[model samples]
Target: MSNKIKEREIQIERLQNNLSPIRKIAGWTAEVLGDKIGVTKQTISNLENKKTPMNFTQYIAIRSVLDYEISNNKENEVLPKVVALLLDCDDELDEADYSKVQDVVGTVAATAAGGTSTDKLDTVFDVLIKTLPFVVPIIGTIIGTSANWSKKLFK
Candidate 1:
């Protein structure tokens, strides 16, 4: 590829990388975001994972849809806020807890989508319960919150 073409590809890859965490934090799946952006899930996946070339128009559309979703549903920002507070806590967290955070997100989402795995649900709650000392205070610090937020959510 020419130098200019290579530079453009780099820019596209950078844009896709930046958008991914925002999409996850906003609770959007590829299919859902693709639908909102007038593209297919494969297209979004290609852009995010395979460094597929995207033009300016596609970039704008993807960004606009994500921006709209985040602006309209500020509640979706809770996970990141809680995570930031967890990282700030004086107590040390087990290295395993970091990996379990991903599991908790996936398992909880699956449960919400009617997944029938009771065992997985139990595991998710177990991770949450383990993290309660770090999470509960941050949640309580947030207004309109209560300690009951952590109690047996899966039960």
Candidate 2:
């Protein structure tokens, strides 16, 4: 087999490993993600187990669903913890902090409503910058910012 093929296989294995935890973090069972991806539960399990390789289309579909859940807080079934944290100190918030919070909330809301466009890399960057004070680093890692989905978005 070609070295490029072998490297691609390794990358897919790594992606499968990473995807399992992200799916769990998003509160999605294999069955749930499978439904979203139009695949069977067994197929989802196989992918998660790294017993099967995911095609580019499957990766994109799964990433889209995960991104929606993260931005919308659907996984937690509540407002983002960052919002609650900001709210808890609302009385003491300075103008700057308040403005930052508002911007973050607006960005998240907009993204939830499908406000982001691939053509607008600036919008994505804006959202990322606004979310920096929150748990976005961890979230980004889980969702694989270096993955093809983000590369496509930034491209």
Candidate 3:
């Protein structure tokens, strides 16, 4: 390969390597990309290795699909936890999981590009889910609201 091709190959490797979350969460690999885009596994390997250049659309599709998969996994992971919490599971969620549940949902929904009614609904639903947590980081709001409500109730 020429110097430019070699450099691009390195870049592809770096990009794929950086997608740790995708691999860890959703098991995405170049082979997965090839399936999604109708390319051969070899072509995906070449693109990812920077042996061949990828077009902007292909890059975007890779990112979009990979992120969608990862984020969907994250959202799915949270649901059982949240439901378990509602059922009074012994384990409490960490702050990060609480925060990330909405984030992952939002990212996946937003990437849908209005393709379906379900997609639009998901985007709206994710927005709402993500908004549900603004109260958590505010430590005193609930306490204060309770106090005020108590005062009114007693008065």
Best by TM-score: 2
* Model with the higher TM-score, candidate 1 or 3: 1
Cα RMSD, each candidate: 11.7, 13.8, 17.7
Query: How far off is residue 71 in model 1, in Å?
Result: 1.5
Each candidate structure's count of clashing pairs: 0, 0, 3
- Which stretches in model 1 have alpha-carbon errors above 4 Å? 1-12, 78-155
Worst 10 residues of 2 by lDDT: 78-87
- TM-score of each predicted structure versus truth: 0.43, 0.45, 0.34
lDDT tens per residue, model 1, 65-150? 64455357554544333333222222334546634544554445555346434345445544664664554454435423322222
In the range 1-155, model 3's lDDT, one tens digit per residue, is 77655544443443443332332223345566679867777877776456776664564465456535534655433222222222111123355653454355334434432333443444454455556564234323332232132132224
RMSD of 2: 13.8
Index of the highest-lDDT prediction:
2
Worst 10 residues of 3 by lDDT: 81-90
Q: How many pairs of residues collide in model 2?
A: 0
The segments of candidate 3 whose C-alpha lies over 4 angstroms from its true place after superposition are 1-25, 75-155
lDDT of each: 0.50, 0.51, 0.43
